[model samples]
Target: MNEYPIEYYQFFIKFNEGDYYTCHDLLEDMWMEDKSNLFLKGLLQMSVAIYHYSYGNVKGTRLMMKVAHEYLQPYRPKQWGLDLESVIAYIEHCISIIPDDIDKVSFSKIEELPALPTLFLYLEDD
Candidate 1:
């Protein structure tokens, strides 16, 4: 089996750990190098959307989610060993749960937000 890129592993780890900001940062470098890769851009936008949501930026989250969905649509079911269907469903769920007005969202309100699942890429056993 082929080895996945290091950044991919880092993305999975950071994203699952609820560090969306770091996920965004880690993927940005890769996205910069391959601007034409919609997959990378979608993943990066997804990370940024989550980061925005985590920080109570409703508008930013909404905007990013829309773009992320669009960018990711072409690669359905799977891409780069990722389960795009599951990831897309998760994003949809996020869009549904994110409040229209996040400014007044308190800690308790934040607690109401659904927990995001981690993307598990297929990897070869050592």
Candidate 2:
């Protein structure tokens, strides 16, 4: 397998562990090093979205999900051993569960919806 940065792999570890905040922090340095890396940006945004969803921040979740989708779309079927298609579909499903009018909804209401699944990132052997 091709080598990757420790942080890159750690991000997925944190994400799968339901530690989205840590996931975001783990990749911040890498994403900062390459501001133009859409993959990193997308993953960061996705982590933030899940973090917000976990806290029932309706508006934040919705906004972050939208941005993550836009940043990740170009990657399409796959990128860096990650399945972008499945990731995007998961984002779309998350967006669908969130109410359109954030003001009309309460955090408690959001808690009633199905919880977002843990996103496991499996690095493919090249």
Candidate 3:
């Protein structure tokens, strides 16, 4: 397997720590450096979407999830040892739980949202 970029590893470090916002910052900078990298952009959007969900920003959450799904879907199965399929599946799972109407979900309802697993756990071991 090809080695992942240092930024990619660092992104996971922040993401696995429940620091999705930081993950978004880190990956967004990296993605900016390589705008042609669809995978990086997808991961960046996923991070931001998760961060939005944590803060109960339902609109932002759905918007970013849609961006992430659109960008990541074409690079499925795996990418640079990361299991994109599993990552996409996790994103889909998150999207599935969102209320049809954001207004229907209160703060307590947001609190009741399921805790998502770390995407690092789905990484393929070299």
Off by over 4 Å in 1: 101-126
Q: Write the per-residue lDDT of candidate 3 for residues 8-43, one digit (tens) a residue.
A: 778877888888888878887887888999888898
TM-scores, one per candidate: 0.80, 0.89, 0.84
How big is the positional error of residue 22 in model 2, measured in Å on the Cα after superposition? 0.4
lDDT of each model, Cα atoms only? 0.77, 0.83, 0.78
Per-residue CA lDDT of model 2 for 1-126, tens digit only, reads 778889999987788888899989987889999999998999999999888877677788889999999999998888888888889998998888777766234566766756776567777764
lDDT digits (tens) for residues 1-126 of candidate 1? 446678878888887787888888888888888899899899899989878766556678878988899899999877877878887887887778666665435545665655544554443343
TM accuracy, model 2: 0.89
Candidate maximizing TM-score = 2
Estimate the lDDT of model 1: 0.77
Better of 1 and 3 by TM-score: 3
lDDT of 3 at 1: 56
Off by over 4 Å in 3: 103-109, 112-119
Residue-level error in angstroms, candidate 1, position 37 = 0.7
Q: Which ten residues in a row have the lowest lDDT in candidate 2?
A: 102-111
